[model samples]
Target: MRGSLGRRELLKGTAGSVALGLTTGARGSVSAAPEAERRRAVVIGSGFGGSITASRLARAGVPVLVLERGIRWPTGPNAETFPHMFSPDRRASWLTPRPVLTGSPPTVWRPYTGVLERVRGVGMDILCGSGVGGGSLVYHGMTIQPSAEHFTRSMPAGLDYERFDRDYYRRVESVLRPNGIPDDLLHAPEYRAVKQFHDHVAREGMAPYRVPLPIDWDFARRELRGEMKPSYTTGDVLYGVNNGGKRTVDVTYLAEAEATGRVEVATLHLVRDIARDSSGRWVVRADHITTDGTVRERKRIVTDALFLGAGSAGTTRLLVKAREKELIPDLPEAVGSNWGNNGDRIFSWTPLGDSPGALQGGPACMGVRDWDNPDGPVTVVHGPVPFPVDLGTTSVIGFGIVRPRGEFRYDPHRDDAVLHWSRSYDAELTDRIRERIRNIVGGSLADHLTNITLDTSAFDTTTFHPLGGATIGEVCDAHGRVLGQRGLYITDGALIPGSTGACNPSMTIAALAERNMDEIVAREVGKVF
Candidate 1:
């Protein structure tokens, strides 16, 4: 196999291809026997945290192995590497019988290792990405850094906001290279909805600033100029971006780690359990599966150091299950505590007057930051839905400060950790967000309909950004080292204390991972690895 497969050159058996250059030994069929392997360090899930951890450790001369549950999604100028939003198939969901998105029809789909996973919980359902790039692949690319005041309030007091803004945040931005949408692109004929949103915010006496997105603006410009396909221009990026522009983790951090020849990323490796061996080393049990959800092989990997970067839900589920099963007997009490949905509320906005064109240029280029609100800070961003015709509808998503009141309990019958959340967990914050949206466009007929009709416009019990559980300062130390477990760590949204100060968690997650890896590489390289 080649050391690195070009993004354009992927296996072509399915609609969504698997790029196996980093996965040197993965198979398509069942193997003769299970495989056993050992590594100096093992990182689970190749999202922002895992990719940063692998890159940093590999640079420090540590050989690392990364396990991802989903297949790679490679893209180029006009590659059909991902499923479109309007015409989704099995490639839109991960082993789900139907599409995960709310408005999607209940069409039964064949099982495949798709990009998105919807983890159903009490009172809410969480949307998590499944592939090598993890959430970065499916996210709207809103790279936001929380303000210092809110950061200090939401996070552990030890994490210096000034230091992160100056150093680690800068590090993440330098690599991701986020940019706001240029004015020329925003004023394009297709982006009428974005302009409408900005005008509404301005009329409501709020400043609508362009959000920094890790996307190549030129790609969108090219689509507008008829040089390529209309992925970004039409906002048809719900599954994954087909025409490569978004700087996802696989192409940035993971690619760099693989280039060092010290990191091996294994895709289609779904981790089932985690425990410690007799010699105090970490033992991971996983299944190597085909894209159709059939297990091809079972594998055991033992490592001196293990980092849980499988996101808030996945990591917390594994830890909680291990704790209950007594596989890892001495886990902390906070392993399943302090879980949250990041105070998420997504609203569908329909204007009364002018119909914003259906072709809304996106990756969510603009937002209104209401940091001064006494009801707790909130950030609302405008996003475009990939509808082919003018529906006069768009989406506005809000994030705010909500106390983490969700927990996971082990279910023996299912042999898994099930999330338990109250319906009233974030009721107050949800109200604030709803009111804020109403005040933004109050006199409109849409607002009147929202007021009279019993609709989900006020609150939707779903979150793309699930935070906390195995949180920092509770389950782990300030530097993400688990207090009771030696050589075990957390380097994902699971480390955040339920929220990212009213902003999306991606930038903070990346920055915090950079900070934690810095301390870890400096202190524990020779001793732990």
Candidate 2:
């Protein structure tokens, strides 16, 4: 069988994919059953949840094995690993044979597996990421934390808002080092779009409105000076940033985990199932996929403890099937319930007259928080499309206090989780986003929506932030421990009972992971340590 994590390629020029900003670790590639791995803890899916948990576990001297389904994104000497947004190559998708298009027309585009992974649910078309860094590889590096009041509706009752706001948020910031684009750069010619929205929000008297991101400031400056190629300004985040401009988890958390000499990160290890053996230990079944999307071997890994950090869609699908097959029959009734799309509305405005519209300016740099009514809440963040749209196209993405919840139940015929949803579930949020656009750009020709694109399925929209399934106070305990199963925990966005109230959920996911690890370490692995 072929190697799993691409360790064999480390000696070649492709090693940068696995260890982006790390200083240590043997950094072995994934091998299919080269030998059985027995760890104190086995963490599945290396996104925000798995990355932070593995880092904490390794630091505490617990042996950890992190299984990531996608292959490594090795940056060549010229940063060739990450393809440009307009010209996405094989590295862009998770397992598709080509770059799959989700937004607007040109429905069936190219044919190459790149970073953005498309999971076609029965009622929805889900977009997720693959690779060692997981979602971090493809998402905009925004770290917007929701106000404590926004956390009232969902999540565990009587949560310690003080601890989360002060301690956990700071913990995430300490690692991510997010900062607002300097005010000096705000009015610069290259940052016109960023400056434009900043002024709009400021003039509209929006509360706590600003763009905070984890982009490399110096790298952006170089790119602005034409010394570097397009990273953020030219739609770099849409695919994956080829330059060292975006600081994702692989460079930060996973690197720290490897430095401890107690963690082994194995990419291409797609976790498939979980079952309890005779001795009550956990047995994890997985597919060790190669770089070419070939399954080299089916590996069954045994561990003392297991974590379901794959993500909302990923973890929910796995657990729901496991329950139906009686692998973990004691799973709770809320296993596949309380899921949402963050009330997302993906609409764009292309001005009527011929004017050089703004193109991609890296990650989302500004947001408007004016529409948050205690009665009905919503937050709209203005983002750029950065490309052929330069002639006028711009993205209008919104996150509302949407409470419409959907559920995922295993479909025997399809052998996948089918989401129960409808077009009417998003009508309220969509109308709110339209009003936000009108208010923010009232005088501009963009006040009225033009060149709109709708999901053909049900005129439904898409969202990168899919939250809840096996959530806290429901599927898992307040501390993220699954009720029916001990040693099996969830520490991802799946644990967030609802939307993050107009802000991006990455920081909250990381902070909650930090909070959960504090509990998991003290209780579950203290004896082993």
Candidate 3:
């Protein structure tokens, strides 16, 4: 969930396969390597998909090298490894002069290797993560499994929801260990807003369900007990939860992969571009940069197997740029097509007479799944604002089923790819969902609401959940194997066909990768790598 500051307050906030030995470089110094380093497997981006791929491949007796563009954020009790929502610094953004918030005014700062990056496209702006754990580092930890009907409706055919629910989905859950908010935590004094949201949902004749979150409630409880600094309980998770209990991919999957002693994760290595050599090997060009964005070393890595898990924006841009530059021949024409914003809409609602309390507890716990609607399925989650003073406000973010109408086009002048989404891309469906929310909060109690403002952070063609571009079935097969390029694969959100039903894409993306890896390892382990 993308957290937004109050609208009246002026808004704010924010790889391959193969096995081989890795080389080392000097810290903060340039390396003059004569030739490209060779490896058996290289996985780009260390989020859910890449981490899972590396873990599975390593378990299958393959040595893996994982490349992450951002530095590692190691968090502990009271550790200030991440930026706070109210006091953002250079560590809050990726390369941008200011935080990539939609409605916030630009405040310049020195560039650094930050956690989040905003890719500004023509009609849409994508907010993606940049650290070792990728999007999981900043996501609200909503690990939702879409219903079978919705899954079938949005995803490409040939995926069996039954199998996914039984196997791959369980695989992800086993690692992330997602669970509902404990009763004690939800009923605590600090979580009055969450309890109020549940009461409101029940009063509106709808049952509120506890959203499954990959978080350790104990850490939050400790904060309440004054054993740690306030993070989750304070709702200061937009940037990240400083007193980390979040089971982000880096701490879960990537950690396990590294523990196997077969995986090496290179941090602060920004991938520039990718191509295939004459001998049919994958060549990845990257720049080893310092925390201040200085390129210390230019590296050329050749691999036998390559997996692209650089999220939707990063993976899409790399493929689109490679295709336009004629670097990778016969690339899929659909490399930059079928992108969607996941029908994301953020609303700040303040009940007329009720105070939802200040210092709302979160990483979201309560939501309503209105899947039975005839028009289209929609899911709404209650978002808690972490403010020190009561503003009589809380937030609700809605996700709806929408067509993938956005496309990414290569911008030769900028030497990059830009998204082209129509202003009215999913207007009807999002409007329908908006009406559903309005009815729930404003219908009979319309006069009882003090205010309801659509946050421009999401309303202004911006999305925290960016899906598609190099989507499955168009650029790759059902198993994530690129159609024309053997040993090349997509194991990230980019493979998702625009939306993961009406749910967030994390669970589905990881499940799909698990399914793909099951086939890839069984069929082409020793043979390919």
**Residue 113, candidate 3: C-alpha displacement in angstroms:** 0.4
lDDT digits (tens) for residues 30-94 of candidate 3: 43542578899999989989999999999998999999988899988899988877567888888
- Candidate 1 residue-wise lDDT, 465-520, digit = tens: 88888988789999999988999999999887678999999999999999999999
Candidate RMSDs in Å, in order, are: 7.5, 7.5, 8.3
Worst 10 residues of 1 by lDDT: 6-15
Model 3 TM? 0.92
Model 1: pairs clashing at backbone N, Cα or C within 3 Å: none
* TM-score, every prediction: 0.92, 0.87, 0.92
Q: Per the 3 Å backbone cut-off, how many clashing residue pairs does candidate 1 have?
A: 0
Better of 1 and 3 by lDDT: 1
> Which wins on lDDT, candidate 2 or candidate 3?
3
Q: Name the candidate, 1 or 2, with the larger lDDT value.
A: 1
Residue 214's lDDT in candidate 1? 96
Sort by TM-score, top down from the best: 3, 1, 2
Q: Quote the lDDT for 279 in model 1.
A: 76
